[model samples]
Target: MSIDAPYATLDPDRVLDAVTACGLWPDGRLLALNSYENRVWQVGLEETSPVIAKFYRPHRWSDAAILEEHAFAQELAEAEIPVVAPLPFGGRTLLHHDGFRYALTPRRGGRAPSLESTEQLEWLGRLIARIHSIGARQPFEHRGRLDRATLIAKPMQAVLSSTLLPSSLHAAYRAAAERVDRAVADRFEAVGPIRQLRLHGDCHPGNVLWTDAGPHFVDLDDARMGPAVQDLWMLANDEKAMSALLDGYQQMRDFDFGELALMPALRAMRQLHYAGWIAERWHDPAFPAAFPFAGEARWWEQHIADLHELSEELT
Candidate 1:
């Protein structure tokens, strides 16, 4: 953490003071939460329950984009969807202390959602559908949509720019990546236009918290305009689970069956994006320590091979 340039200035005293800046008294309990793109902490209060403070990554989002995320969360919460929205401090949700932009929200606890359970998948599907319903009501003026360029091409560029890929493997990497890129583009064109809507952009299991009562959404950091299927595909691991989820989803809202075929391309884009994200953020001390595999030459070999395999499937 000390080696990370982004968090170098953010110490324990500063974190607590950021809370105090919001007119909250800190009990001096600060625990680092599991987040890499941005820094998050569980800050204990002197009186009431603890609050989750999320310090936004520097330069990643503008003020309007961040506020748009807050507004979307509030919209979902207002619609009776169990989403963890930011709490206003002095009627402002976004705050700044020193240089970091941050927000405060009530801490909600739950375990990872059970994707294997049919009932759980259905419940999650319904909640996601409801979220999409609210998401579809309007458009995001600031946050950008999830698309092929951002997810695929941009990431592959990051990998090429970085020294992570050995010199010998550069040609192979580029060939595999370009092949995947063209195939991904073809799939998107074939799918024609998709119903783009505001979505929980990164809707994987890790982002969802499940309790006995039901699941609640946390972390709107990745919230953006995207296909509704972007929120649905990551929740299921197999055909059966996806079927259950779609069954529950169709009960509340009509879904485009065409988007189902777009999964492979989306998955391929995500694969490229993941590698690219690690490459782009490798300068951050946290990324290298966490993704040691990216440091290895063989990983690049495997990644290129995987890209080739994905290209085969896509073509």
Candidate 2:
């Protein structure tokens, strides 16, 4: 059958059936959660509390890679970190049904963490530090890295290959992107060799939920090996905020100050990767509906201009 939507294969009935297969009796109520990369649902149970069921995007990750992420989250939980880990079902964390891979976790409900609060930022910083401590303990055997090849090269290739990019904007985009790529490489070179460790990979404010106890990290879908600053930079907005976060971070672990110099390069890489991600996923019906701007020639023009500006900033 042809796929019309990203979750075309993930019907509500299939999700409930998957939960039932895990020995959890579903109450026939399924609430689809906010997610673009994967299909997540809050499945109501008959006797127990509702559980969050996440069906991984097909072909996005290998079985071993997803299992590695589960192992990392389990490690953090074992250390008493406030991270939502996958609940093992039938002696395994990863399960397969109807050609989809998924994992079940107890529902965690909380509002977004207040990034504006110094106290809250500090608390989060400490928690992230503790997570980094465990992340540094070992390397992922199956997972990938956050470096030039993955961040810049592969993404650039994807954008060039995708039909989403307007032909009129191709020359400008290629010129700007190549310049940005070079600048990124140069910035990384100037920073010299920095330490890389397993990180939360995507530590934006949305991934964190705050409550009375503290903040708990939820998605490990992007977890991989990368510079520690990769996790820290996304949390802070300005110098003052970064200082506040580092204050708490230092209390728990020593951070390499040199990594600060690499932030611009990382930002440029993220910009490129994000565009490529949208272009690559444009075939999924959700992408067009959610990111309609990407289809416009003016948007590509502006995107190319932004790339040029990033290259200038890097220079």
Candidate 3:
């Protein structure tokens, strides 16, 4: 599909047709479509058996990343991590349809548990540690350190250059952005070498599914070779959430105290990046309501508050 093509509206019949074409479904009823960066359809066939057909938007993701994800999923499956392995179709990791790339995997049954609960929070932390443990021993090339400078400068540059954000938010966003930039720099300067490992770039609670066995991470699309702390930082932004997750990780592997101490600043950088992205995409009607211009403004306000709090500690 064209990079500028409108978002595709998934219909049950169309999903079934696509599944039938892939030979995974002679006949089935589409249960639900999980529409996000990609489009996934839950298909129910005979005997309560279900599978998911995922259509990848080439415009949204680089071909390299998509293919790498397929390989990564395969490797994770081999390591006996509970994951939905992609099925081969037409000898390709993706199926081309109307200029969009698509793939399929059987749906793993599970519900997303609340991160608010102590038990669930602990479970999440341990699961992340296991993923990191498995990732640690794997032979993957490192994508050099995503240092404080790059993380801060990139979003600030983007937000400043983009005309998407309103003038009302311009000052607040820039101020918050600068504060975080300085905070990250100061924190990293005092810290030792930060270790890089294969990381699940987006490790928010939503990305993990709690199953009978344990939490199974989906959307390995964001997986990359970067600082392991990037994953931890994302999950640890919320104090309660991080405490729970850390409890779990400590059970499985060791965590660097310095890195844990530096998490607040790292997490602030992450939130800043996301705020910039949201501001840049605000004009789009399909942009998530949760991240509207007002939301971005509020985030910057809160971010500045956090930055002040961190700055006080640093001083």
Q: Going through the candidates in order, what is the number of backbone clashes in each? A: 0, 0, 1
lDDT of 1 by residue, 171-223 (tens): 99999899999998899899989988999999899889998899998888888
Best by lDDT: 1
Superposition TM-score, candidate 2 onto the true structure? 0.97
**In model 3, how many backbone clashes occur?**
1
Q: Residue by residue across 1-315, what tens digits does model 3's lDDT show?
A: 234334344456667777777766435566656554566777776664677778765454567667767877777778777656788877776766545567878777678767668788787777677777877776344332355544667767766766555567668767766766776777877786776666666777677778777778777766766556667665554778777878888999887767776766666766666656554554443565544554455655665576566555554
- Note the Cα lDDT for every prediction shown: 0.91, 0.89, 0.66
Q: List residue ranges in candidate 2 displaced over 4 A.
A: 1-6
Q: Whole-model lDDT for model 2 versus the true structure?
A: 0.89
Q: Residue 101 of candidate 3: its Cα lDDT? A: 68
Task: Point out where model 3 deviates above 4 Å.
Answer: 6-17, 26-28, 31-34, 46-48, 114-122, 138-151, 161-163, 168-172, 233-244, 288-315
